[model samples]
Target: MKKFSFLAAPLLLISSLAGAQEGVPSPAPTPAPASQKEEAQTQLVVLETAMGNITLALETERAPVTAANFLRYADEDRFDGTVFYRAMSVDWGEQPNGLLQGGTQNDPKRILDPIAHEPTSETGLSHTKGAISMARMEPGTATGDFSIMLGDQTGLDANPDGETEDVRAGYAVFGHVVDGMDVVRAIFASPTDPYKGEGWMKGQMLADPVEIIDVRRIDSPEGDEAEPAPKETNSAEAP
Candidate 1:
């Protein structure tokens, strides 16, 4: 069993090909073609980080609850002065394979109540390259912390039949980076302090956290007006 560590606060921690039906010669029913409107059904939000901007296309239709929660934070200016403070690097798979985490970091004033977990099993989203997923301590404890994948981490996807809760109920991937992966890589490559953080997160804390200047919704769905830019503020504390 592949392990995935996407946790909140204390910690942060599938390409599965379906088997062909046996002896079934009947052709499978073709799926209906997606309309132009359906194809363009996504909410775009940009995180203007100190390093650079990272654009995200949230799967609002498929993962509504998770997407809405993130939007609420952005719309209310909760993440304005937050920083990308953790870079979990691993020497496996691709060269820059791991995750970069940032968010409210459980600031009582900035964070909202935890939302329901939306597993890949239900959302049909995978932890592919540039995928953005929530960071929770348990299956249903995710709040404002999130991570951006650096490579195709299919190992993070839910395994419905797995033996453990962590595998059966995987992390919720609500969106993906549509642009500025180079910025993501650069932040991941930034200096990390060897003596910071707790437990498994030790040595993963960024020596100098990259500030998130602003987070704004650049575009909205049909019939929705774009939200005003978030006011600048600073209230987050380093972990």
Candidate 2:
């Protein structure tokens, strides 16, 4: 087990914001009526894993291009049969907690062209627990890979004073895991060490990697629509 610290700065800011709002209690703001535009801007994806199904709600309003890119991969069934090959709990000096990384890699060709990054400042989404964000070697190098933060990650978010240099930046956070967090926790608890050079564990590797088995869009009707039409019900008795 490792130790991780709270992201002090951002947490502090959030606390201050909370206090300020509390000090001057404003009238309860009426909920804005839902619109078609809102529905059109968001997408729900389900990642069927060996552990269980993990459902994500992608925020397209805050990250249109990034969200679209991720959904495109899902829609194409590119992530099916992939694995979550890397898990790292960074020792940030407190209770150790971290993220779970996974993506489509069982078929190399499924990997698509790289997409541009959308930082938290741009998307207005924090790197909180269950948030699904891109994984990259460096800024602006994200591709088919993505991860979900299992805990708060203020260090990975934006800061004007270069405080986030060491932490990954410019990686788009387009969605959040709305269900199946327990599955994520199970994956995180899988056996891990230094990976031997071979197979799925090549390059950035994990010793005992968790196999994804398959990753598919669970809710969409497109797959069903593609199936042959069922025999129509007839008013007359079956022959």
Candidate with top TM-score is 1
lDDT tens readout by residue for model 2, 109-188: 66666677676656666667788877654456455677778776655554434433424243467888878888888888
Question: How well is each residue in 1-239 modelled by candidate 1, as lDDT tens digits?
Answer: 11224332112241111211111111211232454125536788889899998889988888889998898788877889999988876666678878888888777778777799898777777778899988775577777888899986665666665555766676788999988899999999999999987655568789999999888788632223466645444354222
For model 1, the stretches where C-alpha displacement exceeds 4 angstroms are 1-40, 220-225, 228-239
TM-score of each: 0.78, 0.66
List CA RMSD, all candidates: 9.2, 12.7
The whole-model lDDT of each prediction reads 0.72, 0.57
Which 10 consecutive residues of model 2 have the lowest summed lDDT?
12-21
Error of 1 at 6 (Å): 8.2
Model 2: what TM-score? 0.66
